[model samples]
Target: MPVLVFIDQSEGQVKKASLEALTYGAKLAEQLGTHAEGVLLGKVTEDPSLLGKYGVKKIHHVDHDELTHLDSQVYTKVIAEVATSMGAKLIIFSNNADGKTIAPRLSVKLKAALVTGAIALPETGDGFMVRKNVFSGKAFANISLKTDIKIIALNPNAYKIVSGEGTAEVVSFAAQIESPKVKVTQTDKITGSVPLSEAERVVSAGRGLKGPENWGMIEELAEELNAALACSRPVADTNWRPHHEHVGQTGLAIAPNLYIAIGISGAIQHLAGVNRSKVIVVINKDAEAPFFKAADYGIVGDAFEIVPKLTAAIKNKKANG
Candidate 1:
């Protein structure tokens, strides 16, 4: 019984979430007393051998240009084939956009039991049961799998990406890869001050800033702290910021070590997205803002005054260093 992990990549590069999956699979393999391997669908820019540090004994790579772009239908068929050929009893996926589309399809095709948005490693004592977040991270659910094969799509940032002392050998498996039905016409990228999903600290804003012009204060503070800059849905919807910067139930959900919100009245929808942040700081003039309830710390004041003072304090601390 071996564990096979799907390494999600974009533009010839593996995603941060894939590393989390790799780490998770490696630990699972240890717990089960089995070997862990990763399958790279497309040609990744990074050296596949270096991934051995993550505990994948071999990397099954199908380096086709068509594989670079995601085609849910075609990719699912190929991956299911890989799992079957490799005799993978357990398949792991990252609960990112790619996993959201591929995991369900592969589950149906392989007739395997699957759990998405998994928050913790599976409990494999009696039956395979995994704990996951429900109700937008407000609740938890333990799903038990009852199939010969089990599939899990792990939620990003839920598990730590841990590595050990040794590197494993990388073996290349040859498979008949196929072209995807969907062609890559273009891709609009989101550039962040800090990688949002992987950032330890996040600074966010909303319509309370009034307009894009006032975003400088937020940026200045984030930059000073080397934190990711994020926004609420209204900011993204109104074009004050890009959609990628949106963090909420309808947008990108994050669980950073520290999340700072300034000038935004937190709506329940928005709260659902970022409620997982280890520490939440809400800065709103209205002390009664709903976000304050979820926040670990609250300050009732104007952001314009508070942000500059905070930025100056951080800058001063850095200068002294």
Candidate 2:
């Protein structure tokens, strides 16, 4: 049976997480001695055949206006239909907002085993076991699935994306799509900043930055490193920064490649959200700050004095290169 990957898109553009899911699904298909195929519901600006670069052998596209905005019920039905038509035993999704909503519903409908927040490829030798994060990123757990149809939602940033020189054959899929009950009357997009959920590098601050007026250095450093700007819960609560930029358990959870925290005292709630980052750098004046323990690299200095130096150093390196 072939492996089916859901290609999540927004505004006619594919999300990075979806690309990661495609890479992961393609590798899984290789292991299972089968081929990986992608299914996209909405109209996309980019050619679906280009997904072959990530190892997808074929792409089934259903270009419909109704699929543009995500309607969980409608999307689930279409995906179920595609999976049935393609004889896909394994379905893969990125454990993002849409995935979390759609995977479980589809699992119930298909009578499949569902696994969310998968951190690694499954161990087929051990009855198809998958490792996942538990305890709010504080620990790990291995789950075993014993069902005919299996669905896995991969955690963002948990898998490496591998690309090759190839092009996928694009095939048109005719799904019985239905009218969406949920109508998006209007949309408000966050402008002038990177989407925190997809950012690879992030620079976040807290109360120690003192106030919103002191955010210039933090913004400059983030710009220098081409990192997304984020903040702790307190910063957002105090209106120092927009709530969308907040990163904590009570806010937006992020798992970036590099996370730099300046002036934030690492509370458990804050750590819960960002601890999954590949590398964490903490800058705090207090020597005994809790964030130092979790940081891959820690700098004991004032943000005001250290930020400018760090920005200048990065600029110099770029100039020299």
Candidate 3:
């Protein structure tokens, strides 16, 4: 059976997480001695055949106006039907908002063994065993799935996206399209800044910045680095930063390539959401701050003094280059 990957897109553009999932699915297909295929729903601006560069051999595209928006129930039914028809033993999804909603539903409908937040590829030597993050990124757990059909939701930023050269054969799939139960009247988008969830780099701060007035430096640093801006829960609760900018155990979880923390105490709750970052740079005046323990590099200095210097240095480097 071929490995089938669900390609997630937003506003006609493919999501980075979906690309990662595609690469992962392609690798898994290679491991299983099977070909990798992709299933795309909704109208996309880019050619679906371009996805073959990530390693899929073919793309089954369902282009319909009703499929533009995410309707988890409808998507589950369509994906289930596709999986059944293609005889796909393994199904891959990116563990983003869309995948989180549909993967579980499809798993229940198909009676497949489901694993979410899969950080690594499965070890198929003995049985199908996958490693995943558990307990809010605190630890890792290897789960064994004993089922004929398996479903995996690859965590965003957990797997590297590998692209080579190839063009997938695009096949238009005629699927039973259903009207979405939920209606989106309007969408308010935050523009002019990198979205924290998909950002390669992030600069976050906390109450230690003292007040909202001090946020200019943080923003300047983020601007210099071209990184997304984030804050701790207390900053958001105090209205210093918007709630959407908050990242912690109870807020948004992010695993960026580079995560820079300024004036944040690095509480366990806060760390839970960002610990998966490849590199953590903590800037705090308090030398004993808990965040330093998890940081790849620690700067023991005042944010007021250090942040400006860092921003200036980055600006100078860019200017010189």
Winner on TM-score between 1 and 3 is 3
lDDT of each: 0.89, 0.93, 0.94
Residue pairs of candidate 3 with colliding backbone atoms:
none
> On residues 1-321, what C-alpha lDDT tens digit does candidate 3 reach at each position?
999999998889899999999999999999989999999999999999999999999999999998888989888988998899999999999999999999999999999999999999999999999999999999999999988999999999899999999999999999888889977677687989888998999999998999999999999999999999999999999999999999999999999999999999999999999999999999999999999999999899989999999999999999998
Comparison by TM-score, 1 against 2, better one: 2
Candidate 2 residue 109 Cα shift, in angstroms, is: 0.7
Local accuracy of candidate 1 as per-residue lDDT tens digits, 1-321:
789999998888888899899999999999999989888887777888788888888887777777878999878877887888889999999998899999999999999999999988899999889999899999999999999999999998888898766665666666666667788899877654567877889999988899999998898899999999999998999999988889999998898989999988999999998998999999999988999999999889999889899899989999997
Candidate no. 1 TM-score: 0.94
Off by over 4 Å in 2: none
| Candidate 2 local lDDT, 1-321, one digit each (tens) | 999999999889998999999999999999999999999989999888998999999999999999999999999999999999989999999999889989999999999999999999999975899999987888999999999999999998888888889999999989888999989788798877778898889999999999999999999999988899999999999898999999988898888999999999999999999999999999999989999999999999988999999999999999998
Each model's total of backbone clashes: 0, 0, 0
TM-score of each: 0.94, 0.98, 0.98
